[model samples]
Target chain A: MPIHYPNGRRFHETNTKKRSPAPKKISYSNRGMTLEEDLNETNRYYLEHGLAVIHKKPTPVQIVSVDYPKRSAAVIKEAYFKQASTTDFNGVYQGKYIDFEAKETKNKTSFPLSNFHDHQVVHMQKVIEQNGISFVILRFTQTEEIYLLDSRFLISYYQNMDTTRKSIRKSDIEKNGHLIKMGFHPRVDYLKIVDSVYFSN
Target chain B: MPIHYPNGRRFHETNTKKRSPAPKKISYSNRGMTLEEDLNETNRYYLEHGLAVIHKKPTPVQIVSVDYPKRSAAVIKEAYFKQASTTDFNGVYQGKYIDFEAKETKNKTSFPLSNFHDHQVVHMQKVIEQNGISFVILRFTQTEEIYLLDSRFLISYYQNMDTTRKSIRKSDIEKNGHLIKMGFHPRVDYLKIVDSVYFSN
Candidate 1:
């Protein structure tokens, strides 16, 4: 006997219920995985390869109420997500402090300044003042392009937003920012760009 | 009319809540605040005075379910506390990466190894291998003494735990670690010890 699904697909009467193999030319980039997931995978690869030690800060949540239904485990009953005070990703790389925020925009021509918060811009400035490397990873999702924009340039643009344009043009980013080439194992090899830009003698 | 307690003590009629402007003999070290609260206050002071930027990472929680009863807010109905992958406090100071785990013990003689997890030790090792400064802030609550113990000594001790004692003795900590003097504005001035140990020329 064969078990039939709603689409009239039947499972063969076998001990191992194996499905058909996946297509050989499947593109992982377009497989609906979120940008954060890709970055997490990249970080894991970096950690395993002993290249760098970086991690995304866990999302902060304000717990309001809890229920201790059993003595062993406590259950959170009510909580709300809290705004993060600093950038998402941070770690040590080659004896230098690395801190950055990642954002993806579907726009084609410009990267909006509204994607960044005032506190985050201020935090990045502090990191730069301390001589630590700080930058933003902006992904133009429509074109599948990513650029690492230094905080120094970002701060100048942020401070002059009252007089200048509210967003940075794609042409300016193409000129100033380091384009990160997509990779298979690490996904986003941003550290390679960091080495060339910040550590190059 | 005033509210009275079950023991017939009137709230407004009591003079226990009143305090006199007394002599400067009170010691903040003996105050009822927990070690975590004091560290949080110290970090806040550091941030406000432009000294160092450090923060205690929030408690991690694994959210199992959420209820979107309204469009305005998503209420967390069930969640469990998750063990943190990295140490609690991490930040940059003077272009150097700083990472550490803080622990307070009620035991008078030694700090127990059971307080630390295997993964935290591994994480600290990775931080040190990358040339970042890593350590543990151990506070003996009974004696109100705090010491910054470097990860090198910690890793050595952790490795030989099977043959050696299960805890780091107070004498060992006093000899190997830097004693952090308690302060007024910043309760625990651990960065002063960091400056002397890692940055002093």
Candidate 2:
């Protein structure tokens, strides 16, 4: 069944074992792009044009096995996470600190609250307390439609995780999130909204 | 013979591998208490107490191997770096972004510039272009003294790699950088300088 979000977009559903898309649609890596790759390229474009400065926060890895085949370079053999992180990208946009996580989901019905981690919610809350702007950029894999959801809504739902309401309906995301238009050079040009909301300059 | 840094701190000539003196020194399954561990704890304390906020930039790693134990969890099997990273930590402090690399050296005499990768210097330059503050924190393992050297100094010498003056002299860092007084709570209390420089209010 085609999953319909109240906001209007329809999400196509499928079960695949790999990170790569099955046969018909786009394969994340085959487009010669991972989410990080696209954003990094986008950030470079932004940096060059003097539009805005942003970057992917490095993935925190706890490396365990290292092989010193030579004296110069060492290779990681094993590793694990110290803990869950807050987000993937964060930086200054027009004098205000901006933080966010970018995620892609294949679920047609709803973007599962399970997609959002507990620690990430905590991180966003701390950002709010410090008066920083935090949000999540969510993309429905089937439709390739992307939306930016404010971290406030995310945090509120996160706190009520124990309550009757758990998963945020797809309709809510489409309504609350600012729809970001996809572009050619940067792919996802999100700073357009930043200028409208945070800078106003 | 012990490595002779112009700074007065002394590392033992014998490589007995003396246990770190502080009882609270970080030691979990990972590589003892990493430079990241101390900085993170420090950043958190800084945040809770209204001290300057700092965060370690995730290390940019290339994933060559990944194993899916189950559909629920993705296990990374192997990874490497496409290129070196700029530094470990960068974030906003008092309406200004703060960026820096933290390193600990057993050599009492001086820090080896080899510890820093080339791309990191380039990263700092980019951050500076955006009017961000960039720096390096050098910990003399023998003395456990933490010094914050502004990126300007590191950049000037880093650029002159073709000529002499590759590694920064300990004496130069001691004179130019702010000597951070290590404390019980924060481990490395760097926010004191941030407060003086950015947030006097």
Candidate 3:
């Protein structure tokens, strides 16, 4: 026997008598989706819930040419992706300006500093100087763990790179960063961590 | 005699002896550039002076198809411009979230409400509800005058459109909006106006 989905994909049916009585909880972290997709979904949830107004900036592209065919919409025919000058996410949250860059790594032991660009470092520093909350969300895909690392600590490491190691180890993150617990609706409920870390004072 | 520019474009030179003794002041407003270009220049000035950290979000595009030719960059062979979910300019300034949309109208008497979309109105409303600063920068290109109209007033007019007019008259803007004095360094010194209007007690 086979169970067919609405889109017509059939799954081989298993014997009911030999199966365990209890059903197992589904784990979303193993779904093989990118971290970006998860963050987008989480942002959408936050927006609908009136928790935050954050949004990911669109991908920058250098449009070189466009074709306007007769009785049709104009089409971008030739373009190249451009390097972004700012971080991906920014918005207002609880009367404070929030800006952050999200990155995921398969490497379990450390998060490479090379994941960030020099301009992004400068931008984050500027944001901090202006008293806005700036941080990076680091997702360790292997462990399904997320950490919020403040820009002050990130800048210290960036400036002293000549004397220190090139990457921030998992131990350093575990000590300085705040871990974000996974959620059912808003998969990454980062604002909860923001409240405790930034507003606790 | 003709005066030639550095790039070799000849400007018809009226007799040097007949011209005024003192050099005439250059008018930047008559430079024939778009409002977007002026705002970009102003934003650059603000960033350089550490006055603000504002940027225009990149235009959203839906990339439908791409072709990777041999030995060269990937070509975006087919794509369409997507409607932006948020306003154009957004950033943090003086610890407050700043968000705005810029528009220029050739008509000197009024600004057509049709320049805005329903979603933009909703987004601005959300920004206001969260206690963030939100507004519109309306430039009358014919008069070379700029005005900052707060979202609260704009929303009032938008909601009462059935009984009200289709556009905001210049007289109404003159009475309700803050006029931004044009300057040389930052052509539109809008943040100064923001300070006076939003932060002034």
Winner by lDDT: 3
Candidates' RMSD to native: 10.8, 9.0, 11.1
What is the lDDT for A14 in model 2?
21
Q: What is the C-alpha local distance difference test score of candidate 3?
A: 0.77
Score residue A85 of candidate 2 by CA lDDT: 64
Candidate lDDT (C-alpha), each: 0.76, 0.65, 0.77
Question: What digit string (tens of lDDT, one per residue) describes model 2 on residues A1-201?
Answer: 113212221110122113442444455432523454456777888877866567776555555555545444445555443344667787766555678888777776577677788778877777766677788888777766778888998877677776566677788888787788878877888888766766675
lDDT of 3 by residue, A1-201 (tens): 122212222111111111233343323544543455567778888888787889989777777766666666667777676667899999999778999999877788999888888899999998987789999999887789999999898888878776468888899999999999877667789999999989999
Candidate 2 is scored at a TM of 0.76
In every candidate, what fraction of the native interface contacts is reproduced?
A: 0.52, 0.19, 0.57
For the second chain, the TM-scores of the candidates in order are 0.83, 0.74, 0.83
For each candidate in turn, the TM-score is: 0.84, 0.76, 0.85
Which stretches of model 2 miss by more than 4 angstroms?
A1-36, A70-72, A80-83, A107-110, A161-164, B1-37, B47-53, B70-77, B81-83, B106-112
> Cα deviation of B3 in candidate 1 (Å)?
21
The number of residue pairs in model 1 that clash at the backbone is 0
Q: Which candidate number has the best DockQ?
A: 1
How would you order the candidates by lDDT, starting with the best?
Answer: 3, 1, 2
By TM-score, the candidates rank as 3, 1, 2
